[model samples]
Target chain A: MRAHAQLIFWAVLVAALALLPPVVGVLHEPFYVELVRRVMIFAIAAASLNLILGYGGLVSFGHAAYLGIGGYAVGILSFYGMNSGWLQWPVAIGASALVALAIGAVSIRASGMYFIMITLAFTQMLYYLGISIEEFGGDDGMRIKTRSQFSGLIDLADPVASYYLVLVLMFGTIYLVHRIARSRFGMVLRAAKSNEARSRAIGFSPYSYRLCAFTIAGALCGLAGALLANHTAYITPDFMHWTRSGEIMFMVILGGVASSAGPLLGALVLLVFETLLAGWTEHWQVILGPLLVLSVIFFRTGLAGIIPGAGDE
Target chain B: MPPLTLVFEQLLNGVQFGVMLFLMAAGLTLVFGIMNFVNLAHGSFYMIGAYLTLAAVQWSGNYIAGVVLGLAGTLLVGMLVEVVALRTLYARDHLDHVLATFGLILFFNELVAIIWGRTLLDFPRPEWLRGHVEIFAGSRYPFYRAVVILVGLAVGAGLWYVVTRTRLGMLIRAGASNRTMIAALGVNVRLLYTVVFGFGCALAGLAGLMAGPIYAVLPGMGEMILIQVFVVIVIGGLGSIRGAFVGALLVGIVDTLGRAFLRPLLATMISPTAADSAGPALASMLIYLLMALVLAVRPEGLFPSRGR
Candidate 1:
């Protein structure tokens, strides 16, 4: 919780992520590169979710829909041979933003469990939409023939290039969230979350602030989704499932909420734990499930709280 | 147009589906209303109930007996989960409840898979219950489905009497309205909550067992209907029993009817090929769209609980 502690935490995490590739090269564990790339991509998503869910107090259970939408944006485009990142990535972000606009416009009016369920309903709606589209293989999903292209500046097909790309984006997202959390906009959003009536009395419309936060989070998560598609080179309706959203939410909570670096650490720990557990046994969920329950019960401060300092971000 | 008899059959199917949903939603709403706790794992009870029935029926060779034992087992499991994992979570944030219950879901699912070998299990209907019955001058219906309807209606009636007329029901209503105040009075709110939770689990188990004969019973079966049940509770009003029933029936009927008629309806307006493709997609999305529409008009639901 200390300021310097968080600084050190982010610094170490960035360096470690930045330096994972060569280490993988030395260890001859090429699979780990892909695994950590996934972790970083989701780290971007979890951090974005923390932006709304932690900082603004909006529990949008359908966050994964943006992932699906973003993935599909790149996917459906690539299906038509538009593998260019310039077109695909912006379309991914924009489409997700537009969908978020529609969903948030309707569901943000309600708060608490209603908000949660409504968001879930909307996401499931999109999941069905994804299912009904047969051209891209519907529920079976589609394989990405090529990762997004960058007009010769970069190639997502290259593993190291993709790794660094994800790393840069993840760090940017976390820093952007940290900045937003300290801004005037974040103060109003947090105020509305803590006391809606008081914030409204103070003339800050909670609706607009929360909607803005929700859409921004959705757009950011969409980028993560785009990366997720590139990382896996496949897109499926499964990406939009409510449980996937729950997993992302878990990353935010497991990492710690309202902290700049919490989502990054959380994604790293959870996915790594999963990888290790899966390697250990076929019934890895048996252990992971109870562990999640116990952690939610006991780990109020999350992995971030384990640090010596306990008060900062 | 479809034959009138086919329409009748679909109507009956819709009601049967509605009846099962009511059973699942009833317990959820009671717990949701009274404890203000959201149990995402409620569907686990349904799954366990179905698995228990499959195992018990095989062991006992009696359908009714298997169902009874399964319900009892589900009740016990519900109590154990309530005491061991959930009691402490009552005072925590809903997010904590979501996380914890979600964990329970994962644990129970894998545990069930471990025990049952992860293959889909089927529960056979009793020989007598599998016959068809003439319900009207020309209409014949499946007896098992009729039985499901009867059981659901009977339970709904019993629930109505209990909540409206009985002393325990009075206490449940009081606890739902003011848990602290009920505790302040001589009532042991804790025992009441466990009882409600267990009873709710039993209802869910009953629904699950009955559904086993109708749908494929599998480890994660609970979650498939669990979302629909949540939609029912949401549309009916979170804590209100009347709302749960109405909402359940509405969702069930709309879903069934939509799947049945949407293709024909769309075909009449568009190309048959387009309708064929679009129908299934629209059908799957029907209930969710209904929920969205309901929320748009009445954000608190049709029968919002008082004293929330």
Candidate 2:
């Protein structure tokens, strides 16, 4: 597909998501709103990860650390009686960015197996830290008493409104990532990923660019974490489990990696597949596991690769 | 100050923990270093090892026999996995290895859960191995745990001898540094890979079975200890057995000692309430902080393999 076609595909996706709530309402299937809302939140996370994993070539197996940080930022603040989105959400993003900065700065010094192991080890560190803290529900986690308040700007308590809010944010996240992929900075990031020594030789130090990209991805994922806390009305250290990070990376890969439409499609397909399988049987993962193996073996290009504008669109 | 006996006892406990971690990490890092293949499903071998031991024990009604059968079963499973799923993956990138093995983890976890029932099972030790032994003036440690340490050290020594003195170890060393040269010299790289992977599985199996008698055999139990083993491998340097041994001991002792002493130490330096909370939190994160500092200072690790 041409660039224009790709743009249209994204535009159509957002438009359809924008209009999904009313259709569900007419069909008396209000449950679909929550389902899609959950998908959007995950989609945001997957897309952010793609920025680093796909575009930046930093295989951060610890992305869930941001999710936990973002979530706990909300959960802890709420525990202290701050329900304002303005205060809660920004802190979530900022905290995750800072943590990401610290983690990335240390891990990025090494590449390949060292990098993967370091990222994973660091996340486990946070997981243990989360479990040790006694306040704000510790391992059992705590409930969010209320949704983020906007002072009469828009009521998030309404499912439709919450759905729309997630939809807007998801769409914006995907678009922002797409823009980043095409920019000079994104080029440097991609260049560094493909050939770091070459990029460095050509007067571009890939370190700062990679770190910047990593931080941006972390900050974006933090927002998704905050949204998730609101959506679930609960927060737990389990959010940062390596398995969750794997699932997000799976979505990025399952969708066309490093593409605009890949994560949205991938998240939708995976969640829906999981939902249907879950409804069918309790041991659905038994089937899902082999299917993932087959996909990795066969779907070399991912679901997005099957479409036009497959490579880095 | 903490009691001398208590500290001495904890030190022994830490060494025992390190011994078990060494068994698991040595093989994992060996395979990782030699084949350049990342096998995240190594934990599955551990799980399968525990489960198989349980099944074989119930069927044979003999503890030693069950352990032998369990190790054999785990080794066979490892060989099969390498030949069937992992052989083709050698040509692919690391990401593919990771993802495919991850899928295998899901499959194996579910498979174990399905076959064995999704509940914890008790692994009974032999009659003589059930009691405690006095190792010091005022303390006695669990006999089985002490056995675990002894058995672990003996195997470690055996492994060291084989890898350093034996012809097979030479080939392994040769294979790690230069696969193409070995393959060109008529060595079957494929067979070597399977052998190495099977060895890893057997070692992991041993760790699992020994651990079963100590902790209840349960699904997903391997994952909990696997990360710590990973920390051992990273700190010890990837694919280095000596590194694994040193790394495991360092992590186990540091972790055990930190959890034991951090609270009292923190109380002396800070407020009691702050120490109470911060101590455990920092103790848990200590290994990771150590890892980060290590990686930051030496990316190739403390014992980087010679000649790449």
How accurate locally, in lDDT, is each candidate?
0.89, 0.88
Question: Which runs in model 2 stand beyond 4 Å of their true positions?
Answer: A308-313
The DockQ value obtained for model 2 is: 0.75
Q: Candidate 2 at B224: error in angstroms?
A: 1.1
TM-score of chain B of 2: 0.95
Q: Look at candidate 2 and tell me the lDDT of residue B41.
A: 84
DockQ of candidate 1 relative to the true structure: 0.71
Enumerate the candidates' DockQ scores in order.
0.71, 0.75
Q: Which ten residues in a row have the lowest lDDT in candidate 1 chain B?
A: B117-126
Q: Judge candidate 2 at residue A153 and give its lDDT.
A: 88
Candidate 2 local lDDT, A184-295, one digit each (tens): 9999998988998899999998888988999999999999999999999899999998888878889999997788778888889999999999999888878988888889
Lowest summed lDDT across 10 adjacent residues in model 2 chain B is found at B299-308
lDDT of 1 by residue, B113-219 (tens): 89997888756888989889998879899999999999999999999999989999999999888888989898989899999999999899999999999998888
The sequence of per-residue lDDT tens digits that candidate 2 reaches over residues B1-308 is: 89888898889888988998899998888898788888888888888898998889899999999999999999999999898888888878878888888888888888888888788887889897999899866798889989999999999999999899999999999999999999999999999999999999999999999889877788788877888888887788888888899999988898999999999999999999999999999999998888877777877777777765
